[model samples]
Target: MNIYIITGTSSGIGGAIARHLVDAREGVITISRRENIPLSRIAKTNSSFFRHYAFDLTQTGKIPELMEYIFTSFKEVKLNGIALVNNAGTIDPIGPSGKLDVSGIEAHLKTNLVAPAILINEFIRLSRPLKVSKSILNISSGAAHKPYAGWSNYCASKAGLDMLTQSIAMEQSAEEYPVRIISLAPGIVETSMQQKIRATSAEQFPMQKKFADLYKNQGLSQPDTVASGIIPIIFSDKPESGTFSDLRYL
Candidate 1:
């Protein structure tokens, strides 16, 4: 059986992705602030292929233990293959860098950059020895490759995540037990993050109107649709490692 460990499944793209994985009969462990109820229902109605862990991703200090527990309990099931999707993220401190508060940036960094790095490290350590297909997909953003007026902290954090993906991939390429890794930009989906972006003040976010217009024009992709589109790439044999790409382009 295929196993998928994903974060931030309480809502939006993460939640949608979890649902798809579970529906596809893959055992899924969801890490989020709250349990994903729809997925929990699937666990009951389907084949008990779902596990939920409730914890705040900002509490970075506890991630090592959490990851340790997951690997230990599930390591025996490592024969088939396993995948980790670092999908939890934030769009906070959406304003001018000069006016940003320290706490907001720190929180954003902890959630977006630091948490993923720690998780990736632990993931590699645990899965390296297992003789099975292993993959790590970092849910990157378009901001990582672009400069937005009011997303300094968000952009920088994502850019850092992309770099982390690159560095880890490089080390794994020459190793005996390598893990497939990708920093994937999922594109703009109709999620709460878009609402937050559209609700920003025009003075702080000059392009707020553009986001609003995207919603108005029904241009945003559905979360479930995007989630479905991404699974094949994550599960397929076409990729090895050091893949930094956007889902739309793929």
Candidate 2:
């Protein structure tokens, strides 16, 4: 049985992916701060293997215990493969560097960078002895490579995530069952995050008009579309580990 563990499945890309997996009858475990009502409804109708954890990633201290509980709960089932999608992220503190809130900046880094790093560490440690195929897909962004006027925290966190993916891949290469890892930029998806970006004032985010125009022209990709494109990549072995690519180009 192929199993997938995904973060931030309350909505958007994560929600889309979880729904797809449920429809396909694949084993799925989702983590988010709130329950996904639509996903819960679909899972009930499909009778698929599905579980949801209402946990906040910012509580970084409890991640290992959470991961342990998840893995232990699945000990009775035979698993052919397991994958983790580090898709939870935040783009807050969207203003000039000097004007950003100290607490918001801390929360942003915890969600975007530190949480994923700790989760990956636990996943690798717990699944290392198992011979099953293991993989990690980090939902990165184009902002990681470019510096926007007001996304300093977001940019820094994503860039650090990419490097973390690369460094882990290098370290795991020699393991008997090394995890395949990739950091992918999913392009501009039409999610609530985009709405937040569009709503930001020009004084805070100079690129607000650019995103607004994207929405006005219907230039943004839908959540399901991006999910469809990356689902195959997530399950396939075609891409080398530590690779970073944008969905638009892929």
Candidate 3:
């Protein structure tokens, strides 16, 4: 059986992806700061196939131990494939770089870059001997390529994440069993993150009105729709490692 581990599964695209996997009878393990009630209830009936862990990804020091525990728990299961979806991210400190708080900037980097880096490192080390397909999908954004007035922190972190994915893919290509990795931009979706963006002051985010208008005009993609597009890429071998993709183009 194939197993997938997804972060930020408490809501939005991560939650939708987890739900879809569970529906397809795939083994799914989710991590989030809080429990996803719907997924928890469903796991009650499919205990062996679904698992959840309430985890704060910002605590980077504890990730190695957490990964060890997760891998050990599934040691007995014969697996065909295993994947990691780095979907947990933060878009705080949304303002001009000069006005952004240092603490908030640190927190943003920790969640969007540091935590995923550590998770990918540990995942590779632990899964090295598994003799199964291994993949990593990083949920990136257009902000990584385009700069926004108030999204300095978000853009920098995502850019770092995309480069990290590319570097790791290159290193793994020479290995006997390489892990496939991709950084995908999911496009604008109707998520809590978007809500936060829409609520930002126009003085801070000059483009706030653009996002607000997108919502007003019902132009935002639904989480379920984005998840449906991403799920196939996660399980398929269509995209080459180290490449970048956008859901709108696919």
Candidate 4:
């Protein structure tokens, strides 16, 4: 049996990916901060191989133990672990550079960069003996490459995520570790996150109108559309390891 882990399953790309994976009838373990009440039952309709963990990814200190628990829990099963999607990320503390919230920066680093690396570390250690193909897909953003005024913290975190993905890829390639890493950016998708930012006061969020106009005119892609492109890349034979990719390429 093949196993995969995906973080963030409440909504947006995370939920879309979960549904897609379930429909594909593959064994999956999904993580989210809130309970996906419908998902447990929905997943069973097409696939019996599904599990979920509702926990905060920001708590990096507890992750190693959690990974150990998962390793031990699944020890009895024969497994080929393919992918770990670091889809749980956030863009917060949005403000000018000088007035940026340090707490938000810490939160961004923990969720976007630190936790993913720690999870990868633990998974690699635990799965060393398992004879399976391995891959990691990190959900980054165009914000990482482009400059967004008042988005300094978000940009830095995702930029760090991109770098981290590259570093991991290089390390794995050097060691011939079976794992491959790809950092992907899902551009301008319509989701609740966008809504929240758009709802904020204009004075507090100056970019809201520009973003709203962009979405209104450009027609933002749906989460499902992004997921469709992501699914193929995860299993693609093309060599995109240690690289950043835009969904339009697929």
Best by TM-score: 2
Q: By the TM-score metric, which is better: model 1 or model 4?
A: 1
Clashing pairs in 2: none
The C-alpha stretches of model 2 lying farther than 4 A from their native spots are none
**TM-scores, one per candidate:** 0.96, 0.98, 0.98, 0.92
Model 3 stretches with alpha carbons more than 4 Å out: none
Off by over 4 Å in 1: none
Q: Put down candidate 3 lDDT per residue, 1-250, tens digits, no spaces.
A: 8899999999999999999888777888999999899887876676647878888998999999999988877787889999999999988989998898888988899999999999999999999998899999999999989998889989999999999999999999998888999999999999999999999999889999999999999999999999999999986776789988898998
Q: Each candidate: RMSD to true structure? A: 1.2, 0.8, 0.9, 1.8
The C-alpha lDDT values of all candidates are 0.87, 0.93, 0.91, 0.80
Residue lDDT tens for model 1, 1-250? 8888999899998999888888777888999998878789987798856678898989999999999898776665635888899999999989998899899989999999999999998989888778778889999988998999999888999999999988888998887767888888988999989999988999889999999999999999999989988888776755557767888988
Tens digit per residue, CA lDDT, model 4, 1-250:
6666889888899888877888777777888898666777888777557878878998999999988876676676677656788899877777777776778778878988899889989887877777777888889888889887777777888898899888877788765446788888888888877877777666657788977886779768999989888877785655478999888765
Per-residue error at 152 for model 3, in Å?
0.4
Greater-lDDT candidate between 2 and 3 = 2
By TM-score, how accurate is candidate 1? 0.96
Candidate no. 3 TM-score:
0.98
The alpha-carbon deviation from the true structure for residue 216 of candidate 4, after best TM-score superposition, in angstroms, is 2.3
Ranking by TM-score: 2, 3, 1, 4
Question: Which stretch of 10 consecutive residues in model 2 shows the poorest summed lDDT?
Answer: 234-243
Pairs that clash in candidate 1: none
* Of candidates 4 and 1, the better by lDDT: 1
